[model samples]
Target: MSRHAWIDASAGVAGDMLLGALLDAGARLSVVQEAVDAVAGGAVRISEREVRRGGLRAWKADVSALDDQPPARTWREIRTLVTGTAHAVFERLAEAEARVHGVDVAEVHFHEVGALDAIADVVGCCAALEDLGITSVSAGPVAVGSGSVRTRHGVLPVPAPAVTELAKGWQVLAGGDGELATPTGMALLRTWAGVCEPLPPLTLDLVGVGAGGRDPAGRANVVRVLIGTRSSPIASSLAEPAMLLEANIDDLDPRLWPGVLAGLLDLGASDAWLVPILMKKGRPAHTLSVLCPPTLADPLTDRIFRDTSTLGVRRSPRDKTALDRAFVPVKVGTGQITVKIGHRDGVLVQVMPEFEDVAALARSQGRPERVVLQEAVTAARETGLVVGAPMVSVWAGRAER
Candidate 1:
């Protein structure tokens, strides 16, 4: 059962445009409307009109713009607005934006996002996500418009400072005129989206096209979102990665080596390994490396630097493109355990037991860890599942000589 969702920004996406898109994608308009009413802090008057984007007719979401607008906020005030909204992943995203901009959350006022309508966009999208029960969200590469537009703060460049700041690491292309991807849009995207990278493997179930406001004339201004099924069992996660953490250390203390390897794994490293290499002056130095998921990358790196003698640590994203992996329950010698198996295409490429489960069973039964480990492996092999042949071609490693 593969499931996935995709956002097509070929026409540029906006807040309201996204809401309309969700509605078109099978989101109950009534449900979305009710949620908007509550979050808008007043009666949210919504109207849907049949519009054409790049010659395709679609429903466009439009909320009445209010005259009694809130004051223009910095990234700080905008964050406070987001905080008062909800505690879902969206809230965390608002907070992250504040941290990125180096401002107090609440004081960060709304720029393009300060208006009541913008709030509608956020709440509407959030409500729709909840309604859809979407576990994963991804986007096609976005084309952030260039040039300038008149904003609450005055006339500013196309990818407004706020938008630019919002889309820090996201993949954005170029655009022709008016504000394409707004700050509110960017914040919503960065907060909930899993990856802006090329679409990963997914089994297609549905295709959704979200209509954007104002067709950019001679181009697609509609934000098209594809709602399909994920082909793998990989889960979505985050890591507070150190964007640029690196230090070339030539210091070596063999007595201090054991702690680095053992401690880092405990501290949450995807992998911690070493390579022998010659230093600048031909001195021997172990190139200690640590690979971690984004969330744990920074702290683990910091731990290595602070706890160890390393002066600094080089850090970057360590994104893992996992296969369609799953764990199956197995019983061995009156003991039951789970084994994780990785599948690519459809063939079983790898299999391993749950380390903690095996260790606990070994400890409880007062049996040697090796014996328990072997039992678990044997059980899995006897009753293990097989993946598709295509998967085997991609992931099955060569047998040992």
Candidate 2:
């Protein structure tokens, strides 16, 4: 799928409003329904129609709240709603977040951003993209206005703590008087926007204007989403993608390399290593290399500069083609284990337990980790483990280096 997507934070975005616009714009109802189905436990009523704004026609989504609603949910509860979405990648991303926060993914409730309506907004946006027949999307730079917004959590600061949290590594322009973006809006965009810099190249197909309810003077409170076609093939889609970030080091503590590698892995680096080369005759130096996802390039690279003696990092993009990949959930001896499965044309080609999860399971079970690992392997061989699943990949932290 040469699909691309983008988000526009013109006059700020709220869960309800964006959902409304997406519904109006023509997002798929089924995808939206499936996403939010678990949040409400049954289903939330919704309707959509083409709406006009600024003399331009667009689709808008209307969420029908139930006659009865659940009690005001805590942050912990909100987290579960998305987890319950049942989509592998979504769930894994939620869980990966738990890993980042040092909490069970299920335990980290979503606060105001995770409410049913917010969930509906996300689902609606997902669906609308499907309905729009938009294979690729490009958005203008977001304008995140300055100032604070109130929430159940209390009178938090402007941009909101959640919005600030989600803005990490994202290029957000701040200029609006107040409330140019909402947490839910940022969350969906961060998860879906494959890249956030200068909009990707594309041939304009149509322009979607999601009107913000407010009418800012001289500026329309409208989020403009451009649906378009790529002028060229999405090469990144085919390559066995890898990122190479290099740095020159001459004056760092040698003792930090191991921790750096561990730190990189913790921070979502695919691979990190050092090359010993003589910078000058008799002057031995090292070239540090970090291979990671495009998304992870910035944070982990930042870690190298901070933890090591590197002054800067240089990056080169790379792609490698490989067979399709999958994941399996296997019933090990006493606990379940997740295995990374690779495939070619629906055939199981390779399987391996995620060492980290296996190690955790073994530690909990009071058995040699290898034993738990072996049992998982055996289970996979016997009748095959659970089918493939997506995972959340994050570069959360770096070890002491």
Candidate 3:
């Protein structure tokens, strides 16, 4: 089973604090150290110690720079040192900085965040996640502090311009005084966390509390991580929040509609389709509709604007209910075709052969597509796979295959 990590950043989140929490949560220190060493080029060392934050015990991770004055690195320079998720995190940071300064991403150079210790924190946290086999990550609403903070660019308001840019789609609050969430922390959260919401249903396994530098008077001043296996799928299947984006276009090339729909799906829209409609001036236009998760609404909306000749796009919230689905392969003559099985309450509800597979089989064997689809369905039934049949039949049929 895959493991999930839920970040409790209600207090705040920092790169060092997040790293400490993962370390406290059973990620091997050696694994984190090795990854940090590789990325930081041996210019930094990280260590963790138990500490008290508002009387709550937590792990405090400290990254110390070995070089007295390490050379300032540019976004391009840092981009070359990291790969995969770590690289993505830095890319987000660079983009945020560019947006804040109104400059090109390649021209942005590191200030405080580009330091060796910050590099260690980001790389170590990423390594710790891989070490713990955390496949998914989610975070709660973040608390970005208030008041003024002095930066290399002079005094700036709390939640720094770069941090604000990175927090585009995330939920945030002004929790307390001073800087609570740093740019590095916001970049990490925006890049790694797939969803920002309250705790979801999960079978609790491990908990780690990571302490921030200051132990303020009231709150714990720490970030908490809860690792666990996700609970029942039924909770996720019913009434999930979704978004519907629609635009009517008559000027775009007719042939581009297919590619526009395909592009939406490629960009993470759950479903994209077109509906024919007549505009006010008797212009026959197509209404492009895209269904996607709420998190993707912004990007998909932008895509609609860029891909089609639409002056306006409309968005509405929707409740989407989905079935529990599975796939099993069945023999269609000499070729094997995959069938989709939908279940509800542990009972089989629908069974259909995947059309793409059926079409491929038809073309390969010089048979009509309809004939191949029929054979695939017949093979499924012959193996005891059908609507209203026990789902156990699916497992048994797989065994035969």
The Cα local distance difference test for each model comes to 0.64, 0.60, 0.84
Best by lDDT: 3
Tens digits of per-residue lDDT, candidate 2, 1-401, equal 24444556655665555665555445566767765665676557766666555565555556765634534443455544543212322333344445445776566655444445655676566555556654333345566777676766566567765566666766777756778777666655555443455655656555556765555575556665655555654332356667889998887788988998899989998778889988866788898888888988989878987788777889999985665454556677667777776643223446777999889998897889878888878876653333331111110110000
lDDT of 3 by residue, 1-401 (tens): 55678899988899999999999999998898889888877788888899999988999998999988877778988888887667767878888889889888887887777889888888898888878777667789999999999988999999888888888878999999989999988877777665687997788899989889998898899999998875665654577899999888888899898899999999999999999999998999888999999999999999998888899999999998887687888877789988888865335678999999998888988889988888999999986678876443344344221
TM-score of each candidate structure, all chains considered together: 0.56, 0.54, 0.63
Best by TM-score: 3
lDDT of 1 by residue, 1-401 (tens): 32345777755677777777777777777777787676565645677766887888777888875556545545444444443223232344445446646776655554546566776788788777656655456677777888888865578878777667667777887766777887667666655564576665666665556677676668867777677654444432222333333445567577777787788889877667777778887887777877776677668877877756777676665445655555667786877787777654334667788989999899989999899999898876655333332221121111100
Candidate 2 segments exceeding 4 Å error: 30-43, 49-57, 68-70, 75-111, 127-140, 203-207, 228-401
In terms of lDDT, model 3 sits at: 0.84
**lDDT score, candidate 3, position 332:** 72
Ranking by lDDT: 3, 1, 2
Clashes of 1: 37
Question: What TM-score, to 2 decimals, does candidate 2 have?
Answer: 0.54
Look at candidate 3 and tell me the lDDT of residue 345.
38
Candidate 1: where is the Cα deviation over 4 Å?
1-3, 65-104, 232-401
